[model samples]
Target: MTIFIQSFGYQLWNIITNGPEIPTKLVDGQRILNMNNEFTDHEYKLLQLNAKAKHFIFSNVDRIMVTYEGTNQVKDTKINRLVHDYELFTMLENENISSMYAHFNDIINALKGLGKVVTPRFR
Candidate 1:
Protein backbone atom coordinates (compact mmCIF):
# COMPACT_ATOMS: atom_id res chain seq x y z
CA MET A 1 0.00 0.00 0.00
CA THR A 2 2.82 2.37 0.85
CA ILE A 3 4.58 1.59 -2.41
CA PHE A 4 1.42 2.28 -4.39
CA ILE A 5 0.96 5.60 -2.66
CA GLN A 6 4.58 6.64 -3.17
CA SER A 7 4.58 5.61 -6.83
CA PHE A 8 1.41 7.57 -7.46
CA GLY A 9 2.98 10.58 -5.77
CA TYR A 10 6.00 10.32 -8.04
CA GLN A 11 3.81 10.18 -11.13
CA LEU A 12 1.72 13.10 -9.91
CA TRP A 13 4.89 15.13 -9.32
CA ASN A 14 6.07 14.31 -12.82
CA ILE A 15 2.82 15.43 -14.38
CA ILE A 16 2.68 18.65 -12.40
CA THR A 17 6.28 19.63 -13.06
CA ASN A 18 6.71 18.37 -16.61
CA GLY A 19 3.14 18.18 -17.97
CA PRO A 20 0.51 15.50 -18.57
CA GLU A 21 3.17 13.50 -20.31
CA ILE A 22 5.37 11.60 -17.89
CA PRO A 23 9.08 11.84 -18.67
CA THR A 24 10.49 8.41 -19.35
CA LYS A 25 12.84 6.49 -21.57
CA LEU A 26 12.42 3.85 -24.22
CA VAL A 27 13.42 0.36 -23.22
CA ASP A 28 13.90 -2.05 -26.17
CA GLY A 29 11.98 0.31 -28.40
CA GLN A 30 9.07 0.28 -25.98
CA ARG A 31 7.94 3.40 -24.21
CA ILE A 32 7.03 3.32 -20.51
CA LEU A 33 5.53 6.11 -18.42
CA ASN A 34 5.54 8.34 -21.48
CA MET A 35 2.87 10.61 -22.92
CA ASN A 36 1.17 7.81 -24.80
CA ASN A 37 1.49 5.28 -21.99
CA GLU A 38 0.82 5.56 -18.28
CA PHE A 39 1.41 3.21 -15.39
CA THR A 40 -1.70 1.49 -13.98
CA ASP A 41 -0.25 -1.33 -11.94
CA HIS A 42 -0.24 0.73 -8.78
CA GLU A 43 -3.81 1.74 -9.43
CA TYR A 44 -4.75 -1.88 -9.95
CA LYS A 45 -3.09 -2.83 -6.69
CA LEU A 46 -5.09 -0.17 -4.90
CA LEU A 47 -8.26 -1.46 -6.46
CA GLN A 48 -7.48 -4.95 -5.27
CA LEU A 49 -6.80 -3.66 -1.79
CA ASN A 50 -10.03 -1.71 -1.87
CA ALA A 51 -11.96 -4.82 -2.74
CA LYS A 52 -10.22 -6.98 -0.17
CA ALA A 53 -10.65 -4.39 2.51
CA LYS A 54 -14.36 -4.51 1.98
CA HIS A 55 -14.51 -8.29 1.71
CA PHE A 56 -12.60 -8.90 4.92
CA ILE A 57 -14.19 -6.02 6.80
CA PHE A 58 -10.72 -4.61 7.27
CA SER A 59 -11.76 -1.12 6.32
CA ASN A 60 -14.11 -1.01 9.28
CA VAL A 61 -11.72 -2.73 11.63
CA ASP A 62 -8.89 -0.33 11.00
CA ARG A 63 -8.96 3.35 11.85
CA ILE A 64 -6.86 4.95 9.17
CA MET A 65 -8.20 8.45 9.24
CA VAL A 66 -6.92 11.17 6.93
CA THR A 67 -7.01 14.82 7.79
CA TYR A 68 -8.08 16.34 4.47
CA GLU A 69 -7.36 20.03 4.00
CA GLY A 70 -9.59 21.46 1.36
CA THR A 71 -9.50 24.92 -0.21
CA ASN A 72 -11.33 26.61 2.63
CA GLN A 73 -11.20 24.20 5.53
CA VAL A 74 -9.85 20.97 6.95
CA LYS A 75 -11.68 17.84 8.07
CA ASP A 76 -11.18 14.22 8.91
CA THR A 77 -11.93 11.43 6.46
CA LYS A 78 -11.39 7.74 6.42
CA ILE A 79 -8.50 6.32 4.45
CA ASN A 80 -10.92 4.28 2.37
CA ARG A 81 -12.31 7.49 0.90
CA LEU A 82 -8.82 8.73 0.20
CA VAL A 83 -8.16 5.46 -1.59
CA HIS A 84 -11.33 6.04 -3.54
CA ASP A 85 -10.16 9.54 -4.43
CA TYR A 86 -6.91 8.11 -5.69
CA GLU A 87 -8.77 5.71 -7.95
CA LEU A 88 -11.00 8.49 -9.20
CA PHE A 89 -8.26 11.03 -10.01
CA THR A 90 -6.10 8.57 -11.88
CA MET A 91 -8.96 8.02 -14.29
CA LEU A 92 -9.54 11.73 -14.85
CA GLU A 93 -7.27 12.29 -17.81
CA ASN A 94 -8.68 15.74 -18.51
CA GLU A 95 -8.66 16.93 -14.87
CA ASN A 96 -7.09 20.36 -14.41
CA ILE A 97 -3.78 20.98 -12.69
CA SER A 98 -5.29 22.64 -9.66
CA SER A 99 -7.55 19.70 -8.94
CA MET A 100 -4.63 17.37 -9.36
CA TYR A 101 -2.58 19.42 -6.96
CA ALA A 102 -5.41 19.39 -4.47
CA HIS A 103 -5.60 15.63 -4.59
CA PHE A 104 -1.83 15.36 -4.38
CA ASN A 105 -1.75 17.45 -1.26
CA ASP A 106 -4.57 15.49 0.24
CA ILE A 107 -2.75 12.25 -0.43
CA ILE A 108 0.39 13.62 1.20
CA ASN A 109 -1.62 14.48 4.26
CA ALA A 110 -3.14 11.01 4.17
CA LEU A 111 0.33 9.51 4.14
CA LYS A 112 1.27 11.46 7.20
CA GLY A 113 -1.86 10.24 8.94
CA LEU A 114 -1.05 6.71 7.93
CA GLY A 115 2.46 7.08 9.31
CA LYS A 116 0.98 7.94 12.66
CA VAL A 117 -1.08 4.79 12.57
CA VAL A 118 1.86 2.59 11.56
CA THR A 119 4.72 3.98 13.63
CA PRO A 120 4.36 4.42 17.38
CA ARG A 121 6.80 7.35 17.44
CA PHE A 122 4.56 9.31 15.12
CA ARG A 123 1.66 8.72 17.47
Candidate 2:
Protein backbone atom coordinates (compact mmCIF):
# COMPACT_ATOMS: atom_id res chain seq x y z
CA MET A 1 0.00 0.00 0.00
CA THR A 2 2.80 2.40 0.85
CA ILE A 3 4.62 1.52 -2.37
CA PHE A 4 1.43 2.13 -4.30
CA ILE A 5 1.01 5.59 -2.83
CA GLN A 6 4.64 6.42 -3.47
CA SER A 7 4.33 5.33 -7.07
CA PHE A 8 1.13 7.31 -7.53
CA GLY A 9 2.68 10.40 -6.01
CA TYR A 10 5.70 10.11 -8.29
CA GLN A 11 3.55 9.72 -11.36
CA LEU A 12 1.34 12.63 -10.24
CA TRP A 13 4.41 14.79 -9.85
CA ASN A 14 5.55 13.88 -13.36
CA ILE A 15 2.11 14.71 -14.73
CA ILE A 16 2.23 18.07 -12.99
CA THR A 17 5.72 18.95 -14.12
CA ASN A 18 6.63 17.20 -17.39
CA GLY A 19 3.02 16.55 -18.40
CA PRO A 20 3.34 14.58 -21.68
CA GLU A 21 6.70 15.26 -23.35
CA ILE A 22 8.69 12.11 -22.58
CA PRO A 23 9.97 10.99 -25.94
CA THR A 24 9.65 14.60 -26.94
CA LYS A 25 8.49 15.37 -30.43
CA LEU A 26 10.16 17.73 -32.83
CA VAL A 27 8.01 20.65 -31.73
CA ASP A 28 9.15 19.94 -28.17
CA GLY A 29 12.52 21.56 -28.86
CA GLN A 30 13.34 24.63 -26.85
CA ARG A 31 14.83 27.63 -28.57
CA ILE A 32 18.44 28.33 -27.70
CA LEU A 33 20.06 31.66 -26.90
CA ASN A 34 23.80 31.11 -26.77
CA MET A 35 25.89 33.96 -25.44
CA ASN A 36 27.49 34.05 -28.86
CA ASN A 37 24.01 34.00 -30.39
CA GLU A 38 24.77 30.95 -32.53
CA PHE A 39 24.92 27.19 -32.42
CA THR A 40 28.10 25.33 -33.25
CA ASP A 41 27.88 23.48 -36.57
CA HIS A 42 27.76 20.13 -34.76
CA GLU A 43 25.03 21.41 -32.43
CA TYR A 44 22.97 22.64 -35.37
CA LYS A 45 23.23 19.27 -37.11
CA LEU A 46 22.33 17.42 -33.94
CA LEU A 47 19.24 19.56 -33.53
CA GLN A 48 18.19 18.83 -37.09
CA LEU A 49 18.65 15.09 -36.57
CA ASN A 50 16.73 15.16 -33.32
CA ALA A 51 13.77 16.79 -35.03
CA LYS A 52 13.90 14.36 -37.91
CA ALA A 53 14.10 11.25 -35.72
CA LYS A 54 11.30 12.37 -33.44
CA HIS A 55 9.10 13.17 -36.42
CA PHE A 56 9.76 9.80 -38.03
CA ILE A 57 9.03 7.88 -34.84
CA PHE A 58 5.97 9.97 -34.09
CA SER A 59 4.55 9.38 -37.54
CA ASN A 60 5.11 5.65 -37.34
CA VAL A 61 3.80 4.82 -33.86
CA ASP A 62 0.41 3.10 -34.13
CA ARG A 63 -2.65 4.40 -32.23
CA ILE A 64 -0.76 7.60 -31.62
CA MET A 65 -3.00 9.29 -34.14
CA VAL A 66 -6.71 9.61 -33.46
CA THR A 67 -9.49 10.96 -35.63
CA TYR A 68 -13.24 11.31 -35.73
CA GLU A 69 -15.31 9.09 -37.99
CA GLY A 70 -15.46 10.13 -41.68
CA THR A 71 -12.44 12.36 -41.42
CA ASN A 72 -9.39 12.57 -43.70
CA GLN A 73 -7.42 15.24 -41.91
CA VAL A 74 -4.60 14.37 -39.53
CA LYS A 75 -4.47 16.46 -36.41
CA ASP A 76 -1.44 17.34 -34.31
CA THR A 77 -1.53 15.48 -31.02
CA LYS A 78 0.76 14.76 -28.11
CA ILE A 79 0.64 11.21 -26.77
CA ASN A 80 0.72 11.09 -22.99
CA ARG A 81 0.99 7.56 -21.59
CA LEU A 82 0.24 8.72 -18.06
CA VAL A 83 -2.99 10.39 -19.14
CA HIS A 84 -4.05 7.21 -20.90
CA ASP A 85 -3.38 5.16 -17.76
CA TYR A 86 -5.37 7.64 -15.69
CA GLU A 87 -8.27 7.25 -18.10
CA LEU A 88 -8.05 3.49 -17.77
CA PHE A 89 -8.14 3.84 -14.00
CA THR A 90 -11.35 5.86 -14.28
CA MET A 91 -12.88 3.25 -16.55
CA LEU A 92 -11.99 0.42 -14.21
CA GLU A 93 -13.42 2.36 -11.28
CA ASN A 94 -16.69 2.79 -13.14
CA GLU A 95 -16.70 -0.90 -13.90
CA ASN A 96 -16.18 -1.97 -10.30
CA ILE A 97 -17.51 0.47 -7.74
CA SER A 98 -17.10 -2.16 -5.01
CA SER A 99 -13.33 -1.78 -5.43
CA MET A 100 -12.60 -5.23 -4.10
CA TYR A 101 -9.13 -6.67 -4.49
CA ALA A 102 -10.64 -9.70 -6.18
CA HIS A 103 -12.25 -7.45 -8.79
CA PHE A 104 -8.97 -5.64 -9.23
CA ASN A 105 -7.19 -8.95 -9.68
CA ASP A 106 -9.77 -10.01 -12.24
CA ILE A 107 -9.25 -6.78 -14.16
CA ILE A 108 -5.50 -7.13 -14.06
CA ASN A 109 -5.64 -10.75 -15.14
CA ALA A 110 -7.91 -9.93 -18.04
CA LEU A 111 -5.48 -7.31 -19.22
CA LYS A 112 -2.53 -9.63 -18.71
CA GLY A 113 -4.26 -12.25 -20.79
CA LEU A 114 -4.52 -9.68 -23.53
CA GLY A 115 -0.86 -8.61 -23.17
CA LYS A 116 -1.45 -5.37 -21.34
CA VAL A 117 0.06 -4.29 -18.05
CA VAL A 118 -2.34 -4.14 -15.11
CA THR A 119 -3.69 -0.70 -14.33
CA PRO A 120 -2.78 0.42 -10.84
CA ARG A 121 -5.21 2.09 -8.43
CA PHE A 122 -4.91 5.84 -8.20
CA ARG A 123 -7.08 8.85 -7.41
Candidate 3:
Protein backbone atom coordinates (compact mmCIF):
# COMPACT_ATOMS: atom_id res chain seq x y z
CA MET A 1 0.00 0.00 0.00
CA THR A 2 2.89 2.41 0.77
CA ILE A 3 4.48 1.67 -2.59
CA PHE A 4 1.22 2.26 -4.42
CA ILE A 5 0.72 5.57 -2.56
CA GLN A 6 4.23 6.75 -3.51
CA SER A 7 3.63 5.96 -7.18
CA PHE A 8 0.32 7.77 -7.13
CA GLY A 9 1.98 10.79 -5.48
CA TYR A 10 4.64 10.88 -8.17
CA GLN A 11 1.98 10.72 -10.90
CA LEU A 12 0.10 13.58 -9.32
CA TRP A 13 3.27 15.63 -9.03
CA ASN A 14 4.06 15.09 -12.69
CA ILE A 15 0.57 16.13 -13.72
CA ILE A 16 0.84 19.30 -11.67
CA THR A 17 4.19 20.18 -13.16
CA ASN A 18 3.13 19.71 -16.74
CA GLY A 19 -0.07 21.47 -17.66
CA PRO A 20 -2.11 21.04 -20.79
CA GLU A 21 -0.79 22.57 -23.98
CA ILE A 22 -2.25 25.90 -24.99
CA PRO A 23 -2.92 26.56 -28.65
CA THR A 24 -0.40 28.81 -30.36
CA LYS A 25 -3.11 31.02 -31.85
CA LEU A 26 -4.22 32.07 -28.39
CA VAL A 27 -0.64 32.82 -27.44
CA ASP A 28 -0.04 34.92 -30.58
CA GLY A 29 -3.23 36.88 -30.08
CA GLN A 30 -2.25 37.57 -26.50
CA ARG A 31 1.24 38.61 -27.54
CA ILE A 32 0.01 41.09 -30.11
CA LEU A 33 -2.62 42.58 -27.83
CA ASN A 34 -0.20 42.83 -24.94
CA MET A 35 2.60 44.57 -26.84
CA ASN A 36 3.53 48.26 -26.99
CA ASN A 37 2.31 51.32 -28.94
CA GLU A 38 2.97 50.08 -32.47
CA PHE A 39 1.07 46.87 -31.96
CA THR A 40 -1.64 48.78 -30.11
CA ASP A 41 -2.05 50.96 -33.15
CA HIS A 42 -2.23 47.88 -35.30
CA GLU A 43 -4.82 46.42 -32.96
CA TYR A 44 -6.98 49.50 -33.30
CA LYS A 45 -6.68 49.51 -37.06
CA LEU A 46 -7.22 45.78 -37.17
CA LEU A 47 -10.51 46.11 -35.31
CA GLN A 48 -11.85 48.52 -37.90
CA LEU A 49 -10.46 46.57 -40.81
CA ASN A 50 -11.71 43.33 -39.34
CA ALA A 51 -15.17 44.74 -39.15
CA LYS A 52 -15.01 45.81 -42.77
CA ALA A 53 -13.65 42.45 -43.84
CA LYS A 54 -16.36 40.62 -41.92
CA HIS A 55 -19.07 42.68 -43.53
CA PHE A 56 -17.57 42.35 -46.98
CA ILE A 57 -17.24 38.61 -46.65
CA PHE A 58 -20.73 38.11 -45.27
CA SER A 59 -22.55 40.67 -47.41
CA ASN A 60 -23.55 40.57 -51.04
CA VAL A 61 -20.47 42.44 -52.28
CA ASP A 62 -18.90 41.12 -55.43
CA ARG A 63 -15.67 42.94 -56.28
CA ILE A 64 -13.56 46.01 -55.58
CA MET A 65 -12.78 48.63 -58.18
CA VAL A 66 -10.47 51.60 -57.80
CA THR A 67 -12.07 53.60 -60.59
CA TYR A 68 -13.27 56.51 -58.48
CA GLU A 69 -10.41 56.37 -56.00
CA GLY A 70 -7.69 55.48 -58.50
CA THR A 71 -7.46 53.56 -61.76
CA ASN A 72 -7.91 49.80 -61.62
CA GLN A 73 -10.02 47.48 -59.52
CA VAL A 74 -8.48 44.96 -57.14
CA LYS A 75 -8.29 41.98 -59.42
CA ASP A 76 -10.81 39.18 -58.85
CA THR A 77 -8.07 36.59 -58.57
CA LYS A 78 -6.17 38.44 -55.86
CA ILE A 79 -9.37 39.11 -53.99
CA ASN A 80 -9.96 35.37 -53.83
CA ARG A 81 -6.80 34.89 -51.81
CA LEU A 82 -7.80 37.73 -49.51
CA VAL A 83 -11.25 36.33 -49.03
CA HIS A 84 -9.91 32.86 -48.53
CA ASP A 85 -7.43 34.04 -45.95
CA TYR A 86 -10.06 36.04 -44.13
CA GLU A 87 -12.48 33.14 -44.09
CA LEU A 88 -9.88 30.76 -42.84
CA PHE A 89 -8.81 33.23 -40.20
CA THR A 90 -12.37 33.64 -39.04
CA MET A 91 -13.08 29.94 -39.03
CA LEU A 92 -9.92 28.80 -37.31
CA GLU A 93 -9.32 29.49 -33.63
CA ASN A 94 -5.59 28.83 -33.40
CA GLU A 95 -2.12 30.35 -33.94
CA ASN A 96 -2.89 30.99 -37.58
CA ILE A 97 -5.03 33.91 -36.47
CA SER A 98 -2.07 36.20 -35.81
CA SER A 99 -0.39 35.53 -39.13
CA MET A 100 -3.71 35.85 -40.92
CA TYR A 101 -4.37 39.15 -39.21
CA ALA A 102 -1.04 40.47 -40.43
CA HIS A 103 -1.65 39.39 -44.00
CA PHE A 104 -5.19 40.73 -44.00
CA ASN A 105 -3.98 44.05 -42.64
CA ASP A 106 -1.33 44.24 -45.34
CA ILE A 107 -3.87 43.75 -48.09
CA ILE A 108 -6.22 46.28 -46.52
CA ASN A 109 -3.45 48.82 -46.22
CA ALA A 110 -2.44 48.34 -49.83
CA LEU A 111 -6.01 48.78 -50.98
CA LYS A 112 -6.42 51.88 -48.84
CA GLY A 113 -3.19 53.40 -50.16
CA LEU A 114 -4.70 53.18 -53.61
CA GLY A 115 -7.56 55.30 -52.17
CA LYS A 116 -9.95 52.42 -52.16
CA VAL A 117 -12.48 52.18 -49.36
CA VAL A 118 -12.15 48.67 -47.97
CA THR A 119 -15.67 47.44 -47.95
CA PRO A 120 -13.64 44.68 -49.35
CA ARG A 121 -15.03 46.54 -52.35
CA PHE A 122 -13.94 49.93 -53.60
CA ARG A 123 -15.30 51.44 -56.75
Predictions in order: lDDT: 0.49, 0.44, 0.46
Residue range 1-123, candidate 1, lDDT tens digits: 334334546544333334343345588999765443453666455445444434433343343233223411332345556655555545258878888788677765785675423222322
Residue 4 shift from truth in candidate 1, angstroms: 41
lDDT at residue 46 of model 3 (Cα atoms): 48
Residue 31 of model 1, lDDT score: 72
**Alpha carbon lDDT at 31, candidate 2:** 42
Q: What tens-digit string does per-residue lDDT give for candidate 3 at 1-123? A: 234223545433333344322212246446323334434554555445544444543352333232323323445546665555544544245648678677678767655554544454334
* lDDT of candidate 2 at residue 110, scale 0 to 100: 54
Superposed by TM-score, candidate 3 places the C-alpha of residue 82 at a distance from the truth, in angstroms, of 5.8
Q: Using Cα atoms with residue i matched to residue i, what is each candidate's TM-score against the true structure?
A: 0.24, 0.24, 0.24
Instruction: Give me the overall lDDT of model 1.
Output: 0.49
Order of the predicted models by lDDT, top scorer first: 1, 3, 2
Error of 3 at 52 (Å): 51
Model 2, position 87: C-alpha lDDT score: 45
